[model samples]
Target: MNGDNRIHLVRDEIRRVSACDHATLDAVAELLGTREINVLAGRLGMVAAHMASRAGIAEGMPPPGTFPGAGNERIDLAAQWNAVTVAGWFVRKKLTAWWWHDVLFDGVLVTYELVKAFVTAVVDDDPSHITRLTLRLRALSAGRLVIEVHDSPENAHLISAADNLISPQVEHVAHHCGRHEHQGRTVLWCELARPELSRWI
Candidate 1:
C-alpha cells in the first residue's frame, strides 16, 4: 500500500481498538470513510502480534531470533507478524472496554491504548509496558533498513528477545522513565532510530 493508505490503515486500527461494539465500529469505520472489514482486520491483526510479542517477551516467551529465510518473503512474514501483534493488543482492549463500558475510565485507558499502539508501531520489537519507548534516527546507505530496540531502567528487568535482530551501525538508547511525573503527566519514551526517514544521495 501507499504511505497515505498505510497510515490510514494504522489510524483505523487505532479506532477499531477504541470502539465498544458493532455500532461503535460502524461509526468509527464511517468516520474513517471505509467499510472494508478485511482491511480493518488486517490492521487489527498487525497490532495484536505486537501486543502479544510484548506480553510474551515480558513473561519469558521470546520472539524468533532469526526469521529462518532470506529475501523479501522473510521480511514480509516478519512485517505480517508484527502487524498482527500490534493490532491484536488494541482489539483485545476494545473487547474489554466493550465488556466494562465505563465512560469515566475511558480517557485514561484509551490514552494508554494509543500509547501502546504508537510504541508497537515503531519500537522494532516486542511491547513491554515495563519500559518507556523513545526514538532516534540514524543515517545509512540509501534504501537500507536498520532497526534497534533496547530496554531502560524502568524495563531492565523485562529483557526483550529481539535485541539479536539488531543490525550493525544501528544505535539505540536505553533509559528508565521510572514512574516519574512530567509536566503533570506520566511519561515513557524510547529512543528509536528512524530508518524509514533516512535519505540517500
Candidate 2:
C-alpha cells in the first residue's frame, strides 16, 4: 500500500477506536444505517438482522509480504472489534448476544492490553517502525474466539517477546488464554465462555 493510503487507514482507525471506546447509542445507531459503517461492522464478524457482511480484503492494497507490508508505512492503523467493542455495539443496539457481553468483555480487553503493553515495552515505538496496528478476530466456535495482532514476518522473533506477558492476566482469568503458534504466525489469544466467565465477571 502507498504511504498516503496507509495514513488514511490509521487516521480512520484512530477515529473509530475513539468512537467505540466512547460510544453513545443515538449517535452511533444513525451512522450504523449507512452502507460504509455497516460494511465496516460486518467486516469484523458483526451483523444484525438488517445487515450481514463478511470479512474481505481491506481497502484492496494487501499491505506487502506474505501479509500486509510497506517500507514507507508511517504508522499502522486498522478498525477492529474487540470483545469490549463488540459488547458495546450489542448493548447499544440491544442485540440478543448475551455471550458477547458476558463472556469476552474483560477477557479480550485484558489480553489486548497485555499484548499491546508488550509491544510498547519491548519495541518502544512499536516493532512496526511506525506501521499500522491491525488485529484480526476469529470465532473458533460459539464459545471461543481468538484475537490475533501480527507485527510482520520480518520481525518473527519478536513473537517470543510476549512469552512473559500472559502470566499477569492469566492469574486473573486463566481460561485457555496465552500465546500460540499456528502454521508460521505467532498470536496472542484468549477464549471466552458464558457460564465459566461468570466467575470472573
Scored by lDDT, the top model is 2
lDDT of model number 1:
0.33
* Per-candidate local distance difference test: 0.33, 0.43
TM-score of each: 0.24, 0.41
10 residues in a row with least lDDT, candidate 1: 68-77
Model 2 C-alpha lDDT per residue in residues 1-201, reported as the tens digit of each score: 999999899778756654664447457667665775656654443212111111221322111111112011111332222333443333323213323555445544554564454455346535345333335444433334334445556444555554565556544663455555555555554433335322111
Mind giving the per-residue lDDT tens digits that candidate 1 earns over 36-134? Answer: 666666545544543333333332222222211211111111222344344334433543543322221332233233234334433444433323433
Query: Where in model 1 is the C-alpha error above 4 Å?
Result: 1-19, 35-41, 64-201
Model 2 clash tally? 11
For candidate 1, the per-residue lDDT at 194 reads 18
List all candidate RMSDs to the true structure: 19.5, 18.2
